[model samples]
Target: MTITFRRMTPDDASAVTAFLTANRFPFHVNPAPCESSANKRVAEGHFWSKESQGYWVQHGGKDIGLAVLEDLEDDNPVFDLRLAESHRGRGLGVDVVRALCRLAFTELPQIVRFEGQTREDNIAMRKTFLRAGFVKEAHYRQAWPTADGTRLASVAYAILRSDWENNTVTPLEFDDLLLDA
Candidate 1:
């Protein structure tokens, strides 16, 4: 599968609003977003700003999903990816992730790492991250709030620029420190 990223602008508000409201994002904090709220977010520059930039994930000239890269001014940038309900679970996660990595590292040279977080129960995304050469770096217990009023563990993953360039996974030394009682 070939994936492409098209930078989104303010003029794409209607398209973005439709995309957000048309699909049900089961894993996101707001699974079912209303059209008005979606439009509000776009109007507030949440998608396109100095610190954040959104992209339309395209495959075969069709928009399949949305990817928003945040904290662009920082060395470690993070992203939010949402695939349309119709496009999910057909082996597209890995390709989208790899494409995002390529775009970030190649287009934005100053970023040292590209990061993403997902609910611990989101096994598909976790696997996709691992397969895409991202290392699991952090796990915040009960940090991801769901629309149903429950919180789940937020698992964070990241890929270093050097690691991505070398096609390697750098394992985290989680046991490096021990607390003395």
Candidate 2:
């Protein structure tokens, strides 16, 4: 809980590198050198590369996980996320996802929607997405190769700006607008 979002810089690489290394699964860390370089390039602008832009998950000032949002103009921008093993399964993941959604909707007006996809076997992440109000949209069977040489299915979840409309959260309308046409 109590997460914060901050811009990424070259200064964050060491902290981010250490945060990413604790991953128990190999899926989190992408091994291309260009990935880091590309993020550095994006740091000059408001946008950041999915690899290096470093939107982190911190608990008690320690970097327990890492997340990155990229392709800001896409109908559904891509975000990569990973949490350290010790921090998993404590409901913080959903909390983090909700916080990220608030940021995306508030900061990026062009982002009509936000979406994420994960291997179907990654149930924890899938649950987190659902808890954050992202509805399951599609499942692609045998679309990805797993670490065990078996194919995996990918599932997409999304929530639109229209979906954020709160029927009860806002004060109820009591005027001509509330009357039938």
Per-candidate clashes, comma-separated: 0, 0
Estimate candidate 2's alpha-carbon lDDT, on a 0 to 1 scale.
Answer: 0.67
TM-score quality measure for candidate 2: 0.74
lDDT of 2 by residue, 1-181 (tens): 4876776666776555455443464443242224454445445542344322457677778767767776765757767677777887777888788877887788778777777788887888888877788777778898767756777788887777667544112222334356568
| Pairs that clash in candidate 2 | none
RMSD of model 2, in Å? Answer: 8.5
The weakest ten consecutive residues by lDDT in model 1 span 37-46
> Which candidate number maximizes TM-score?
1
Instruction: Name model 1 segments beyond 4 Å from true.
Output: none
Off by over 4 Å in 2: 26-47, 50-52, 165-181
Candidate with top lDDT is 1
Reference-based TM-score, model 1? 0.97
Give the range of the ten consecutive residues with the poorest summed lDDT in model 2. Answer: 167-176
Model 1 Cα lDDT, one tens digit per residue, 101-142? 999999899999999999999999999999999999999999
